[model samples]
Structures are given as C-alpha cells and as structure tokens.
Target: MDYIQMRQKRFLIAAWAFMECLLFGGLLYGWGSLMYVFKHEGIYAELCNNNDQAALSAMTNSSSSVTDVTLTNSSEETKLSDSNFKGCPEQDSKFTLCFTIASALVCASSAVLGQINFMFGTRVTRLISMIIFVGGSLMLAFVSKEIPWLIFPGLSLLAAGGLPLLVTNTQVSNLFGKGSSSIVGLLCGGFDMSSAVQMVVKIAYESGISRQHSYYFLTALHSLVLVSTFIFLPKDFILNEEAMSTNIEVAGDVNVTTELPIELKERGDVVNEKTGGLKENNYEKKELPTLMSCVRQPLYIMHVFWLCILQLRFYYIIGTLNPYLNRVLNKDDKMVSHFTNICFYIMMGGLMSSFLTGVVYDWQKRCFASSRSSLRQNLMPAVLPLTIVSFLAVLLSALVLVPVQSLLYLIFIILTLFRSFLYSMAAAFLSAMFPSEYFGLLYGIMILCGGVFGFVQFALFTWAETYVEAPRHTDIFLLCLVLVSFLHPLYQWYRCSRAEKELTQ
Candidate 1:
C-alpha cells in the first residue's frame, strides 16, 4: 500500500470511530429524556402512588361524608393518571440518585480504564468496554418496576463502558497530523451527540415504542463496535511516525528491513533480516512519564480545577433539569417534554461546536508553529480556546438564572457549544501539552477529578428539593464559581505572552 491508501484507511477508521462515539458514548448524560421515559414507564411510580394513596386515606379520615371522600379519591386518581402525571419528590429523588451514581462512575472509571488501555492496550480495553456495555444494555432492557434497583447498576455500567470509546477514539487524532486537534474536537463532539440517543429513545417511547425494545435496538448496534474493534483499530496502539518508520510491516510490505540497535535485538526483540524489526509489542514497552509528576504540574492542577467547577455545574443542571423546567414552566408536562426534546436536539450541535473550536485551535497553532519553540511554547495557542470556554461557561451560568421559558432555546444552544468546548478543549489541551504516552493517564486524571466533583451535584439537587428557589440560588453560586475558572485562562494567557516576549528577545 502507498501513502494514499494508508491515509485513506486512517481517515476511514477515524470516521467509523466518530460514528460509534456519537451513537453510544454518553447516553447516560441524556438523563432528561431517558428519565422522562422512565417516569412514564412507572419505574418508581409505586412510590408516588403510595403517597397518593396515603393522601387519599388522610382525606377520607378528615371528610364528614362519603360524597366528599369519593370526590377526593376521584381527584387523586385523576392526578395520578400516567398521561399527565407529575412525579412526587420521592420518585424524582430516586431518579436523581441513579443519575448521580451513574455519572460518578462515568468520570471515576476514566483513570482505571486509561490504565487498562495503557497496560493492556486498545484491544483489551475495547473488549472489556464492549462486554460491559452489552451487559448493561441487556440489564436495562429487562428492568421493570419489580426490579427498579437494576437501573442503578445498569446505568452505571452503561456509562462506564461507553466512556472508553471516547477515550480510545481521541487517540485517532494522532493520525491527522496538523489537523489532529480538529479531529479530537470532532470526536468529542460525537460523544456529546450521543446524549441525543436518549432523546430519540424518548420520542420513540412517546410514539408507542417500549423502552425495552429501544434498548434492544441499541444492543444490536453494538455489533458495529465489535466488528470495528477487530478489523480496523490497531491491536496495541497507533504508532507515531518514528515508530511507524521502525515497523515496515505496517505498510503491508515486509520486504524492507530497518536495523535495530544491538541492545534492542538482544532483548528478545525479533529483528528479521528479511522483514525488518516487526516489534509490534515494543510500543507498549516504551516508558511513560510518571503519573505523580504529571499530576503535580501546575498546568494539570489548574486544568483539573477548571474542569471540576464546570463539570459540577453541568451535572447539577442536567440532574435537576426536569424539576427546573417544571418549576419554570409551572409543571406543564407537555411544555416540559417539548423543551426537553429541543434541548437534547440542540445538544447534537456539539459536533459543530467542537469542530469549530478545533479549527480555531489548529489555525492558531499554525500561526504559532515554530521549529525552534519548546513544546510549552508551541502549546501557548491553547490558552485562547481555554479562555473562550471559560467565557461561554460564565454565560451559560448567567442564562440559567434568567428562568424565562422562551430563553431556554438560546440557553440550550449555548449549553451545547459550552459543553462541547468543555470536554474537547480539555482533551485537546492535554494532548498538545503532554507527551502522547502520558495523554491517556493525564486525561483520565482530569476526568476523575471532574467526576468526583460531580458528586456535589446531588447536594445541590437536594437543596433544590428542599427550597423552591434553591435552583436560582444554585445558578447564582455557579455563576460565581465559573467566574473563578477565568483565572486559569488568564494565567495561561499571561504565560503565553511572557513566553512570546522571551522568544522574541
């Protein structure tokens, strides 16, 4: 195969990975739509019905006549009608808890999964994720009111399993050379769009399709991933240009031989005189930077802090989205459903947002591209993307405070862009600043910290439950916290400017 063939193969692999991510990466985050279906399916409706029954019993005891008791019972039953039923606090809390646990797992497992990828290679990591995802989908498909608790584990596994797809896909950017950042952004965008799957599922459910069947359909789609894993993706990791040069077998022609150092040949590395150094497993043997060293870096610390505040804010907003919409829309279920669908639909725009951001980063990188510059200096352009993300986050928080029904459209639009930037830029920046060898580990740490911060969302949801205006106050608090994120960008900008000045001198 020639250059064109190799490039085409790489592009095709990247495109396929993008499709896989868009379809399955982060469906758990689409909680609003999925929760809507869950509520309609009466996953925890018994709790609400029992509360309704208790209310009925109390009313009967307080009534002086059978007619009054009958009227009260009729009204209660009518309100409990599944068509227009608004869930009780207890039921909503259970859903919130499920999201909290699942989302936490999504973030928390990043490092361990990254480690698995680092140690066991892409094939093993993807296989593990595939099995977990299939099992989770099956579990969710069979979930009923009789076993409502299954949602906890099912959702957890689903989220944890899907994340590796995103992690593995981001590395595909390595194939694109200068356009690598853009590729990373596009892939993250696909992950963002995965949230729309739940939106589709909810729409299907409203159109007479069952949640079980919808999941079964999704489970069937997993075959595409299984096929891609074995056929397209590298068994270990994608080799960079230097590594690629060392392995002549990569181009499907083993006639060429590249001599290896004596040290390597003595270490049981197979150096064929006819076929060159076919050391496919040698990529895994390369030493990566220590995890602690990466963690202790000021840049990593600031990035984690930057990601955590935004992640917590985003998670809280998603976890309480239904209640917040209900409160704003005066519990109009129809309007709430309409807006929820619109919100998720807009989330699909994350792909465009990420692509544009990646373009911006790549363009800026071209401007700053210098053969003499240090890696740190070359990465200075990333500060602009980071700053843009911070500004968007602040704007999103401010918009959340307005509570106008009509503004939700604009809010969702901004939300999609902001979220796309959040994850995409985080990955892009880390990959640009750190060694590719450490990218997985560092990226996982960033995600793990952010995921841990996500737990705070439960507390905020509790506040919203306890106080009618708590969401408003929470928005205000988030706005303030997001303002702090500006510090990371500002500091980076200063560093970039300083580095430029030194370079000029």
Candidate 2:
C-alpha cells in the first residue's frame, strides 16, 4: 500500500474506534445510569401510563406487612423506606436481566458477524451493525409497558451494533504490522473510556434533560458513526503489501512467513521469487487457518479460557457495583455518580499500560532481529509479565474487598485499571499469535466464552446474595473465587515457558 492508502486506513481505524467508544458508552455502561433514571425520574411511570403508582404502593404495603410480621416473630428491628420504593416494582431486576441477556446476544451475533465480514467484507458488515444499533435506540426511546418485549430486541440490537469493534482491531493489526500493539492499545483505550460517555449522558439526564432528549442524543451519535463508516471504510478488504512484507523477516537464517488465506492467493496477488516479497495489486497473500483448526489448538483453548476468566470477574464487578455501593457501602446517589464519573480516569491507567506493552513488544521484535534469533521463539514475551501483573492485581483487589467500604473509591480505581490493562494485553497477545483473517472469528469465540462465563458468574453472585445474607462473608468466597481463577493463567504460563525451553535446547 502507498502512503496515501496507509494514512487512509489509519484514519478509518480511528473513526471506527471512536464509533465503538460511543456505542459502548450509550449501550453498555450507560444502561446502569438509564436504569437509575427509570427508577427515580417517573420515566417508568409515564411508560406504564401512571399505573406504576398503584402497583408501587401495593408492593410497599406488602413489604411493610412482611417486615412487621418478621419483627414480631424474631424480636428484631426491621426498617423500610420510601426511597427504596422510589422505582417501579422490579425495574432493577428487569433492567439487569435485560442487560445480561443482551450482552450474550451480542457475543453470539458478533461471532456470526465475523464470518459475514469474511464473506461480504467490512462495508456490508458495518452497515448491518449500524442499522441494528440505530433501530434499537429508536425502539428503546419510544418503548412503553404496552410493548415491554421491545426492551429485549432493542437492547440486543444495540449491543450487536458493536461489530466494528471486532473489525477495527483486525484491520489495525493488519495495517501496522508489529507496531500495531500501541495502536490497538489506543483503540481499546477508547473503548474503556466509554465510561466517560455514560457519565456525560448521566450528567445530562440529572441536569433536567428529558429521557427522550437523551435518547435522541444517542441516536445522533450513532448517526455520525453511520456517516463515518460510509465515507472512511475501504471498499476492498485487502491487506497492505508493505505491512505484510515487513511482517516477513529473516531470523537465524530462516524465513518467518506470516501466512494468508488461500482465498487471497487466488485474487492475483503473488510472491516474488527474487525479492521474497509480494508483487502485483499491492497486496500480500497468506494462507489462514480455518476456525475449526483454531479450536483444536491447545494454546488457543488456553487463551480463550484465560479471557473467559478475566471477563467473568470484570462483568461481575461492573454489574454489581451499584447495589454494592448503595446497599452494602451506604453511599448516596451523588457519591455513586461521582465514583462512576471517575471510572474512565482509572481506565486511563490501562491505556498507558497497553501502549507501554506495545512499545516493549515491538522493541523485543527488533532485538530478536538484531541478534539473529528466531522471532517465532519470542513471539509472546509480553504475556508472562502481563499475566503476573494481572494476577497480582486481581488478588489484591479481591483482598481489599474486605475493607472495600472503607476505601471504596481507591479499591475500584486499582481494580478497574489493572483489569483493563489485562484486557488490552490479551488482545495484543491474540493479534500477535493469530493470522488477521482469523482474528475476528477467534475473538468473537473468546467473547462468546466470556458471555457464557459471565452469566454463570452473575448467577453465582445472585445465589450468594440471596442465600448468604452477610455481605462481608460473601467477600471471603469471592476472594477464593478470584484465587482459583488465577490457576488457568499460571498453568498456561508454565506450559509456554516449558515449550520455549524445549525449543531452545
């Protein structure tokens, strides 16, 4: 690819990343704040045509009667408050379930969309996702209790609209070669910073902006994404010849070839015999591994398992934070909002970590080349250190939960930053190990596993909260869970180190 094309690809990647950031902000992180509005703002009352008042009153009476009976029987004090009854009956549970189910649907659909991208190319896939997202937002904005089922479809479509996230990472890795790590970091950082988007929306809502206006704002943001996708994304989804050639290097007098799929070879792009470089069409052809073949690889399985574990904890933390703050820590609404606003700043730590990881990764590659050593042998130097830091951070975060209420803000900051750092490191690892053609499919599968594990994690936490009764005691069990989860990465690191030693000997 020429300079102009390279610049264009970079610009498109940035646009896509920004689009994903907005989508995530409005749909993923924004849901919690939206639910708060539904509860406190009379939005649900309007949706239910003011019938919610009668229902909430009846529920409150029933709750008081139950509390009276319990107190009389056990000789203990029980308190009930009007504030607790502020929201529509079951709104919290309804919204939480909607968010969880929507996330799973997004993962499953993204997996399918990955295959579609391979078949139809970037433009079609992006257009489909954009339409779904916009349509879903409109549905959400106008939905009422009469059409309660709309919540499922609306949230699901909005979540699925994140297909560009999968595509952009693959494209950046393909265009930038070894230097893609920092760029990928920037992309993922944009994603993590989506909490800021939600914060902005939340601020707007709290400052007397109507819910309908908030929905309109979201729709406008997604419209920008649609326009950017149409204008910036390339028509032909071909890998850059220069980036591909740079990826092919000589180490220890042996050529390291990054294979493309057989389909690209048939497109008239050919390798030059004399220069050992790609010629014609400014594209490089490489043979890619099929999805089935990828599933059969043990290391691939290990990588997916590690990712699932990471996400299990991540989703659980994010999902439970509001209740944990309000119920367990006794934080007020303003405090909760304040903490949420700071989340993106904490996530910025992950952005820095990811960029540093990329710089180190590229530097290691240069070192291998200069020393005439095998690049393949050093393909994953970043994994070990990243895993160690991630494991320690998780351990500390879990331990701090015992005193979490005392230092709630600090603990969350540390936890969010390190968890995000781990996520970026994992993405970089996959990009380095796999062919770009298969990255999307494989990433989708990883996300699918995460969704499955996340649901299981959510169920476990719900069970604990319902059956255990003591939040402090539950922290002990959660700590144990975090510890057990580390075993997967530790075992994988051991296996990889052993393999590297064997290769050296």
Candidate 3:
C-alpha cells in the first residue's frame, strides 16, 4: 500500500474504532442509564404491577389491592401507591431478566457473526451488524409499556453491533501486517474511550432528556457510522486466496535458521535448510490449517483458556464497578459522581497504555528485523513483559482492597489501565500468530468462551449471595483467578526462553 492508501486504511480503522465505541456505549454501558430512566418514569414498576395483577386474577382469591400507575414527566419523580412501592424487587428482577437475555443473545450473535465473516466476508457481516444496531436502537426508542418485551430484542441487536469490532481488528492486522501493533493499539484505545460515550449519555439524562430521545440520538449516530463504514472500508480487504498465498510465504520465512533451537537443527526441522526461498510452486499444493487443527494445538488451547479467564474477570469487575464503589465509599450523589469521573480518567489511562504498548511492540519488531532474529525473539520483548506487568497489577490491586478506600481506588485504576492495554496486546499477538482467514473464527470462539465463563461466574456469584452467609471474598477469589491465569503466559515464556537457550548452545 502506498502513502495515500495507507492513510486511507488508517482512517478507516479509526472510523471503525469509533463505531465500535458507539456500539459499546449505546448498548452495553448505556443499559444502566436506560434502566434508570425506565424506573424513574414508572415504566418498569407498571410492568411489574401488571404481571402481579394478572397472577392475582388467575387465582380464585383476587383480593390484592390494585395500585394505580401513572407516567411522570422528565422533571417529576414517578410516584406509585403505597401497595406498589414494594414492587421494586419485582421490577429489578424483570430488568435483570431482560439484561441477561440480551447478554446471551450477544454471545450467540458473536459466534454467528464470525461464521458470517468467514463464509460471506467482512463487508456483509459489518453491514448486517450496522443495520441491526440501528433497528435495535429504534425499537428501544419507540417501545411502549404494552410490549416491554421489545427491550430484550432491541438490546440483543445493539449487542450484536459489537461483533464488527473484532472484524475491524482483523482488518487492521491484515492490512498493516501482524507487526503493526501500534495501529492496533490506537484502535483499541478508541475502544477504551467508549466510557466517554456513557459519560455523555449520563450528562444528557441529567440535563432532563427523556430516554426515548436519548435512544433516538443513538440511532442517528449509528446510522451515520453505517454509512461511513460502507464508504470507507474496502470490500477486498478481507482474506482472499491471493492474500493467503502471500501470507503463507511471509509466515514460512520468519523462522531464520540461526534463531532455531539447536535441538531443532539436530532433528533437521529448520526451514532454511531445505526451503531456502519461498516459491509459488512450493505452496501450490500446501493447504492452510483448518480451524479445528488450530484449536487442537496445545499452545492455542492455553491461549484461549487464559484469555477467557481474563475476560471473565474483567467483565465482572466492569459490570459491578459502580456498585463496588458505592459499597466501598458510602458516598453521596456528588461524591459518587466524582468517583465516576475518576473511573473515566482511569479509562484514559487505559487508552494511553494501549497506544504506548503498540508503539513498543512495533519498536521491538523493528529491532528483531534488524538483528535478523526470528519472530520468536520478539515475543518476550514485545508481549510477555506487558502480560506479566498486567497480571501483577491485578494481583496487587486485589491485595490492596482491604486498606484505605482511597488507596484501593488508586490501585484499581492502575490495574484497569494495564488490563486494558493487555487486552489489545493479546489480540494483536493472536492476530499475528494465526492466519488471516481463520482469525475471525478463532477470535469469535475466544469471545464466545469468555461470555460463557462470565455467565457462569455470575450465576455462581448469585448463588453465593442467595444461599450463603459470609460468602467467599470476591476480591480474594478474583485474585486467585488472576494468579491462575498467569500460568499460561509463564508457560509460554519458559518454553520460549528454553528454546532460545538451546539455540544459543
């Protein structure tokens, strides 16, 4: 790609990243604000009360006091009869149900989107995701109390919009080559900045905008994103036969004989001996590894396992951050807002970490290239250090939770910053390790596994809360989980170092 084309690709990556930010903001993080609107406007209460009345009417004794429900304007607090005031539990349950269903759908949609990307291509998958996102936002805006169930499907569509983010990451990796970690980091930074979207929505709500209007605004924004994606993203950027052929040659040549472990040379396994140069005829009959074959690799399995665990912990922490802060600080509204602002700053920290990590990744890659070293030499310098630092940060953050609340908060922020950087770095590393054609499928599988683990952990947490007194310390449990998650990276590092030592001998 020339200068203009490279610039265009970068611009396209930025646009896609922005679109991903919007999808996360409007669908995932925006839920809490939207649910607050439903409660404040008496919509959720009314829905619960209707269900109660229907249940009562079905029984022979229908003597429950009827509670009057009315919609309150944006400026007024919603009021219900005393009999209905206790319906908060039921309303909360209903909201949880919708949220859970939407989350499950998002996971399912991610898997489906991966298949679509593999079978059809990135263009079709992204266009479909964009349309679904807009449609979902419109549904949320127009849904009435008569069909409260519409919220479930609307949220599902919104969640599906997130799938295109993975597609864009793959595209960036493919276009710039696997070593373009800085660019991927820039894109991931845009993703971390999604918290700004939530902040904007919260401000709008505080300014007295109704939920419907907020959703309408999101719909319009997504529509613009859709059009921009269609115009800017190249249709031929996805992996094709030609691209795969070229990449095969590149992958074949990365293993310089000098860098191979001596044991490998003794076994006559080095590539430079027999295949000195990449020729078209050499790969003409070679078949790319299938997705199943990749999955069966021990290293890949370890990667997926640790990635899922990290994602599960991160998702849980993010989902419960507000409640966790409230429990820790016992703050009033103004103070709570201040703490939330601090969280936003932490997000900015994450953004910077991502960008910096990317720059370092590219730098390390350049160093390896200059030294005529193998890509394996770049792994420890470019990726393993970040993983180790992030894991330690998480462990320390959990350990410090028993100290002063303010101190704990600071440590947590540091943890979040590095954790965010680690996520992007891992994604980029995996993208480089795998072939472009199977990247979507593998990435989607990782996401699906993460979602499943998150759901399982959530269910376990709920069970503990419901059935146990003095339940296990969640922080301690998370710390242990983080510790266990580091084992895979340690294993990889050990193998790499051991191989390098043998090669040097």
Candidate 4:
C-alpha cells in the first residue's frame, strides 16, 4: 500500500488500458460484422462453388424457369422464407450447421489454448499470437477461388488470434491495480469507440472501393494495434518481467485507500490474520472457480448469460447492419456512404456518454458494498437498470422502425445509439462480477455464445427478409421489442436473487 506499489499498479493498469484500445481492431469487430454473411455466403458458395450470382439470383427470384420449377407455388412467402431449401433443399441447413459447429469448435479450442497461453505467461504468448494473427488475416486478402478452403486455415488463424482478446483484460489487471475503475472503463469504452471508428473508416474506404477490398483497410489499422501493444505495454507488464519489485505509490494528490475504511472493515479476524500474501499474485482469487462452481452461482451465471444475450443482440444488430440499413433506408447507396454517417455518429456519441457512466456506477457499488468481509464480491445489481432501459429502448426503437421521413430516420439513428449505450452497460456489469483472471475466459465464452447467437440471428433475419417482401420494419422492431421485454425481467430476477444471496453469504 506504499507509494511505489501504487505507482506500479497505475503503470500496470495503463498497460491493460493500452491493450484494450485494440478493441475490435484485432479480434472482434470484423468477425462481429461479418458473422451472418460468413455463414450465409459461405454456405451458398460451398454449394454452388464459383457460381455465386446464378445460385443467389435463382434462390432470390419470386419464380424460376421450367428446370427450376421443382416446387409448386402454393405456400406463403413466410413459409418459403422459413424454408429456403425447396429449390435446392439440400444446401440449406448445411451452412447453418457448419457455421455454428465450426465457431463452437473454435471457441472450445480458444478456451483450451488460453490455459496453455497462461502457463507461458501473457506477454510472450500474446505477442506471438499477434504475429500468427497477422499472418492469418493477411492470407484473407488473396482468397479468390476455393472460399471453402479458406474457411479452414483462415478460421484457425482467426480463432487463435481471437483467444488473446479474452486474456487482455487479465493482463491489464496485472498491469494496473484495481484501485481505480478508470482503467476498466477505458478498456470497455475503447471497444465501443473502436467499433464506431471502424464503421467510419470502413465507410470512408468504400468510396470507390470494391466490397472484397474492404478488409484490406483493416489490416493497416490492426498493424497499428500491434505497434501500440508493444509501446503501451510496460516492460514490467509481466508479473515476472521485472527483476526489481515495484512497491505501491499514489499517482496524484488525491487520497486513495489501500485498505478498507475502519467502519466498513470485516468485524471478525480470521486464521489468516498473520498470513502473507503471495508476491507474484497481483489479481484477486475466486474461492473455488471451477467452471461448474462458477456456473452454479446463479448470479454469476446470470451475469455471464445476460452479458452473452445482450452481446448477442448487440452483435446481431451490428452484423446485420448492411441489410438493416438497406431495409430501413436507401438501397442505392452503399453503407459507407454519407447516408449512414448519422448512424455512426449516433453510435459514437451514445457510447462516449455510456463510458462516463462507469465511474458513477462503480462508486454506487462501493457504497452498497461498504462491508469489507468480502471485499471482492460482485456488484452486478448496478447493471439491472441498464438492462431494463436498454430492453425498453429496443422496444421503443422497434416500434418506430419504419421511419417515414428524414426526421423519423434521424430518430431511429439516435434510438439505435441509445440501444447500444444501454446494452453496453452490461460489460461493466460483467467486469464487476468477475475479476481479471476470469474476465478473459468469460469474455471468450460470452463471445463464443454470441457467435452462435449471430448465426441464429442471421437465420431469423433471412426468414424475415424473405417473408416481409415489401418491408415490415414495424414488425421486425416489435419482434425485437417483445424478445427484449421478456428477457429483461428474467435478468432482473436473476441479478436481484444473486445480490441477495451474496449478501446472505
């Protein structure tokens, strides 16, 4: 708790914050945006192989020629939409299953590899992983023929790179002491900001560029992330990186507590009263954090599950942006055009405001958790209101999905940002529930679920797109609203129950 120690903690936290800035630049955003297209297009390409336009055009047609008139036109569009395989029924579920199964397998691979990476320590492994990541992502630029073949090596490299993202926060916690929430807030904020940034950058590149060349731009941006990782991550970021130990040091004039306030201190003494803490262990410990124990804790489980759900929709909405914008706005223009600028701005503004809320939210948790008996207990109740507001916003936004004028369209723009901001609060909720070690694992698993959610979501969107021929934005909005409304209370129930259980324990 001395000044040197505090200084070390700040230095460490700063390293993690730097790492978080990579955000969607490295592991996440592109995959997030591409989830649906990858599955759908991947399947369509695999089935038809080198004949994309023909297969897609035929499948999309209201009617086909004599050779393609295999199925009669007795069913509603909705029925056919739900079932797109009648024309070439065999290729339908194959894509859906493969995408889901592939992602799940990769997710599992990440979970296992993460444990291996930890054994080698974060700094070396994270950098090595990055080296491999760039090599894999760069291969994507040359993939023209045999797209299915690209799926294997391409996805392997992608998945390998993906695992480090989950571990980055833990690395941050290692760099920065958890005394200030700013580090964590910045990490989460960086993610939203980068996502917004990526959208803008991606749009700008689309001016005269082909869609295939879109990813080429991100390679440069990701290269910047790699450079930043090395520069920002301190030499002492590794627990064993430093030969000399750093003691605690306060960075500013402000008073910071290295111990609980006397009134809030645990009332009783324990057997570990004279126990010495481990020198190398900078992160907090879970009493018994086997996956089952973690999962069995309903509050913790709900925190993870709710985060995954909110993230799933968040990913879903973002992934389907190209089509969503097309459905709700002008189809002639590309997504990167000025027409989509407003949506990007709204997302940027909302995310920044949401970032500022973390300080107040965490302070509130400090107030509620005044007792020091369990100093590291979770404060996920703070997230309940965010869930409620977000779910309601989504419902409200859905109700106004079919904006008739530029004004309504503008409202939808802001509403989408509001929805993003509201749901994004769940990340804060999640960080409070799990400490650094668990943070990466939790993030990886949550995102893995999001991958599957993304697929299901794509399937649903495809069904809806096929059904609502003329475009029913209102119906789609209402559908999202109803689902959110149902899920919100269940999350609330789970969170409150968890808070109560933690208090009782």
The candidate that achieves the highest lDDT relative to the unseen native structure: 1
lDDT per residue as tens, model 3, 47-139 = 455454433333223244546534458844444542223333456556655665666567667777888888887677778877887878778
TM-score for each model:
0.85, 0.77, 0.76, 0.63
Model 3 CA deviation exceeding 4 Å by range = 1-39, 42-101, 142-148, 177-179, 238-286, 331-334, 366-375, 381-386, 389-393, 396-400, 403-405, 408-412, 467-472
Candidate 1: tens digits of C-alpha lDDT, residues 185-278: 9999999999999999999988989889999999999878976677777777764443355544454544544423222322335544444544
Q: How close is candidate 3 to the true structure, as a TM-score?
A: 0.76
What TM-score does structure 2 among the candidates reach?
0.77
Query: Which residue runs does candidate 2 get wrong by more than 4 Å?
Result: 1-4, 8-16, 19-26, 42-91, 143-149, 236-257, 260-286, 344-357, 360-376, 396-400, 403-406, 467-475, 485-492
Q: Candidate 3: which pairs clash?
A: none
Per-residue C-alpha lDDT of model 2 across residues 1-505, encoded as one tens digit per residue:
4435756577666656655653553246445555555555433333342444454455455533322212235744332232233343244445667777876777787778777777787778878887887887778777654565677787778777754554543465556656777666666656665655555666776687765677677778766665545565555353544435444554454443435332232233456543445566665433345777666666567777776666666665665555565564443555666665555446545555555656765665565443222323344365554565457556654755554555765765666555556656667766665656566677778777777776775465555456435445555555666666565556655654564565568
Q: Rate the local accuracy (lDDT) of all candidates.
A: 0.79, 0.58, 0.58, 0.45
RMSD (Cα, Å) for all candidates, in order, is 7.4, 7.8, 7.7, 9.3
Q: Over 4 Å off in model 1, which ranges?
A: 1-6, 49-79, 242-288, 370-376, 503-505
Displacement of the residue 397 alpha carbon in candidate 3, Å: 5.4
**The best candidate in terms of TM-score:** 1
**Rank list by lDDT:** 1, 2, 3, 4
Provide backbone clash counts, one per model: 0, 6, 0, 18
Comparing 1 and 3 on TM-score, the stronger one:
1
In candidate 4, what residue range of length 10 has the lowest lDDT sum? 271-280
TM-score-better candidate, 2 vs 3: 2
